[model samples]
Target: MSNQTSYDVVVVGAGNAALCAAISACEEGAKVLVLEKGPEHKRGGNSFFTDGAIRVAYHNLKDIRKVVPDLTDEDAAAVVMPDYHEDDYYEDIMRVTKGESQPELAKQLVNRSFETLVWMKGHGVKFELNYENQSYEKDGKRQFWGGLPVKTENKGIGLMEQLFTRAQELGIDIWYEAAAVELMKKEENICGVAVEQDGKRMTVETTGVILACGSLEANKTFRSEQLGDEWEAAIVRGTEYNTGDGISMATAIGAEKFGEYSGCHSIGTDYNAPKVGDFNKPGDIYKKHSYPLSIMLNKDGKRFVDEGADFRNYTYAKYGREILKQPDHVAYQIYDSQVRPLLRKEYDLEEATYYKGESLLELVNQLPVDKQQFLKTIEEYNDAVQGGEYNPTEKDGKKTTGLTPEKTNWALKIENGPFYAYPVTCGITFSFGGLHVNSSGEVLKKDNKPLSGLFAAGEMVGGIFYHNYPGGSGLMSGAVYGKLAGSAAARYVLGNKKDTKITN
Candidate 1:
């Protein structure tokens, strides 16, 4: 039997982006086929490991209600919410990347975030307040900070389940364990894809191909080559299957690569966490993001990065690299009873490498670190904390005085009793570099023209992120561009301009 078939669109990778593309293409009356590299259990790429708190522009509670229809009025009235307008969203991306992001792509992502997320909700994706990850109780009210207040229901895995369920409902065919190895093109136009399924190579013909297979973080060689020398030693926080297959295949067909290849989204995860993510503890469960509320100590008992330099969402991604550069590529997050209750729920997990002691010295001795230096560092940090009203929900300006690297915000004295600590290592989420695509989601060639029959989204289509990533924006970017890619690809395959939403 010939291992051949025909479809209007072949979407590589079964993560949030791929699912979005598949569903959108199907809705556009196209025959869509999705090829997932990993098995069914490990399906959603980095998105599966995320907290699913997507950053999108929302005007107020009313805007949020559009995405989350079931949100109670009582819930809305009890919280101090801030409007994340389109300008704020754009500014956040530009500020985090130091204006290094592609202006056009950033604009598209910011402008269409709300609409795209709304569209996903129309397709059965559910939204809810990201209470666990983005909010804190304050003065009888729940205050949401960091401009990221919403997430998918049940977090990352839930988001994937809902998207996958919707894809199935739409009659989109998804093949698990089928990894796209190469793009089959004829005269600069992609015609099919070569995929490996159950250890057998096969080819499937298609009019358009969408590469959403994600980044190169899992491939050790690519990690070192693209990121930096010691990046190979960093732990893969998502899936091992995202070994730059999409980028490699797209680039092979003259797709112009773009963005900061040397940068990625890394986080402080449990030192003892698995090399790849744990499916059972999905959605950033292994991540130690509360470090901003605590001081991170190196093995020498010395404070490295300023733990409170900013909100956890702003600094967490880049701080992992600092920990990886530390001695033994490890560091410890130290907190006291004062901040214990305020710590995120992830700290309470049994998998956390945590230690607690009534006295600071007692906690230091339990861990493998320079005892004298640890004590000294703690003493200095506590002494340096300026007297100020400590507020966890906002940049309270509770700073540290005369410290080498000042805790710029949320600086509270760690003297309230039993101390807590967790060992952390660098956990890389995804690569920042990927193939360049236009506003229409068409992959660009070396001359900056759109490649025929080629589209991309999600991590595989980069330029939205740079040296650092603001938490929750990854999923939003994926949704915004994935919808565009699907619509564009469907238009190309069907050659129907008036019937679809694709603009010239």
Candidate 2:
């Protein structure tokens, strides 16, 4: 029998953004069909790999702090505001995008950020707000920041499941393994998509279509073209489904591309460097594994980053510089016994070749290294920490300054036993490269007009950010844009003036 499907709206991909778009469209009483390229409804495209931290203007940790006892407004805002807001956040966004990030579009995202959160709350996505009163996790173990009272939950997959359930209840049709191979355009407008279903070609027609097929992180062709030759060979340890299907389909129809921020990184070589767990922590949960000050060596064993900044941020900046200068473009993480168990508990740390020797001297004996140079590096760090000599990486802004053993909690006397070491390299997390869309989630062409009958959200669309990424911003953008794209698409379907696709 010949198979066919049609809908008022067609949502592509199975990531968080795709789920949200499908649910929202169905909730609005539109006939929706969701196409998942992956099988068995497994949530492993890109969203499954996310921390699921939602950033909005309302009911944020800051708002909760306002009602909580004994907390001042300034203090609460100071704590959470660093997370994100309009003025400062927008400046950072535009600065990295080099003013190419649509400012008008950014304004809407900033303004509606709080409302978007409220909308999700009205739905059922849970977050780590005022927790059930738990103790803070410090020393980089499964906790947030350096002892903030804030609670954090990482059930982003759970949120996507809820939205998908809502869509199912609304009678939205979801087709698994139904990969969209092409966009069906009628005249100058996108009318539907040609999706592969059960090894057969099928057409799904709609008045509106949303593209959320995710990024080119795993696509060497697209990444090399967008991020240059360096990222071509960069090991991608994450999702392999994001082959830039959205970008390719959009580009076929004259869509513009932006945001070459491909370099946001973390260590993901082995178990100690698992990219999947304890995401609430600043780094990838590896730094807190009782790692000593082994003088973070580059390919040539020279100190690069401060060894104190979150490894995620460290890897990004480090790889950006080191990859170009060195042939292999890698580094080594040296530590001892204390790191092994903690890294295991915090993550699947069994991925590394670990060693527990009688002493640091013995641990060094196992690995081929300049024993004298290693000893001198340790001695220099001990002196600086003992004498309180400031070893600041950046004098003006947030720099390492000094990593004094006496002052630091992770600073246990390394003069003890059972040493350890792990070879660490950068793990490519979310690729910031995506389609060019205004803040209102309208896909833009080179001429700056909204591509008629088309919209995009999530990591699949770009142009709002350029090179650097601020923490929590990318995930927040997905939620904000989902709301924007759905509501804007609804307006276009209802024949209203498309809102200015502007952002902060």
Candidate 3:
């Protein structure tokens, strides 16, 4: 702690979340300072890696009927993830979390979700607003599944660029490449943060402190302890900078955590791009695979996950245990069609030529195992749909929620010859485990009291929703919670509440 350091509020972490908090705090007439651990104006942390989207309904119950307009509690309750109910969403969350969540906070996250998104959009963050499924087309051809915009051109790049630029415009003091070492707290109330920059240690102090420092997936200890022995095998799917320094500091300060039993998000082992070693080559980069046209196999002539389904849905279901159970604990994504043209015009090979089958049989012929086994794999899959089998025995092999047992969706038949395939493991954009928070975006103790002079937002806070991912919810939460945290901090500065403690 430096005697010379002082401000009205100090924000740690310069990602979208921190930027949002700083922008909001500055708007609230608070003298604010922002500390970011990565390169300034560059995509360093998870915010840049984020496929930026935000999901919300409303954070305030009173405003709930207004955001949706004519939505009652029952209707609000009914609108949930397509595959699940809101209550079920909550229960599944607590169960996977092993009851580590704070119930009060969870309720608030779901309720106030919509309002947060609107607030962000009002901030000049253009949200994808069509109501149907469409690709990256800017013509408003399709709205996303849940009737929101894709909200990202490669996640948070445009949006993050805007927020960072806007924060600077607002004159919020920003210190880039500043990594926070510890929290500055007085009797459990956060006051500021201690960060190091350019080999110089500095104490950035404030009356109010916000920890939007992001997730802890980069932290090896948390990964090993929470994920299990094979934790290190799970390569980072996105941002490698968010190592959970803020979370560790919070834990040290007696802030309770939830969702420790299992991960909030599944980490996958699939390599995002062509790299040295392993199985496939440059040709495998984003190449299309035709089943029955191609043969699928693991390192040991086996199939692991269903290759036909949407790759993201596949990633969502790749549990950590399943990745560790394979040969070399790795699987192969084999495909045919010699050149699909990854075709990067920027650098290196624009086309990848990894797995190619002259013909489906020619590719299968190269395999060591009985060709019948690979053929049967495709035959059985096609059979289940044709035979009207309510439950398909397996999707490629593993039974995740990929293609439901409903049996209606069999998009492409595998009979097309000259098949192609490639190997891909599991990976994710970010880990979902974070500090339990309520709809108000207030960080809570296990006992449900808001810590005075302290608030959290972004990947650092929790309890918005689980399993049922609302697209853009992460950015939405960051904006929503950060805004609320700033407003709440302003109230604290104005001497509004004597007790930050509230019991639900």
**Top candidate (TM-score):** 1
- Runs of candidate 3 with Cα error greater than 4 angstroms are 1-4, 41-44, 56-107, 129-148, 267-297, 301-321, 332-354, 364-375, 387-408, 464-471, 496-504
lDDT of 3 by residue, 124-229 (tens): 5655422222222223322122223234433456677677667767877777777878877777677677888889987776667788887776666777776665
Model 1 Cα lDDT, one tens digit per residue, 233-269: 7889988888999899988889999888989989899
TM-score of predicted model 3?
0.72
Please give the CA lDDT of all the candidate structures: 0.88, 0.56, 0.54
TM-score for every candidate vs. truth?
Answer: 0.97, 0.76, 0.72
Q: Could you give candidate 2's per-residue lDDT for residues 1-504 as a string of tens digits? A: 124476677777776677666666656656667778877545435556554544444324555443233455554443422233456556655655557666675666667666665566556655554221222233332232211232224445555666666666677777787788888887878778888877888788776778888777677787777666776645554456777888888889878876665544333343234433332322233422222233344444355545544323222323433433334645555654444443423334343454456876776666555666665655555455432332221111222225432223233234545666555554555566677887767788889898888889888667565555544455567767876777666666545222333321
Best by lDDT: 1
Count of clashes, each model: 0, 22, 44
Cα lDDT for residue 457, candidate 3: 83
Error of 3 at 62 (Å): 22
- Summing lDDT over every window of 10 consecutive residues in candidate 2, give the lowest-scoring window: 390-399
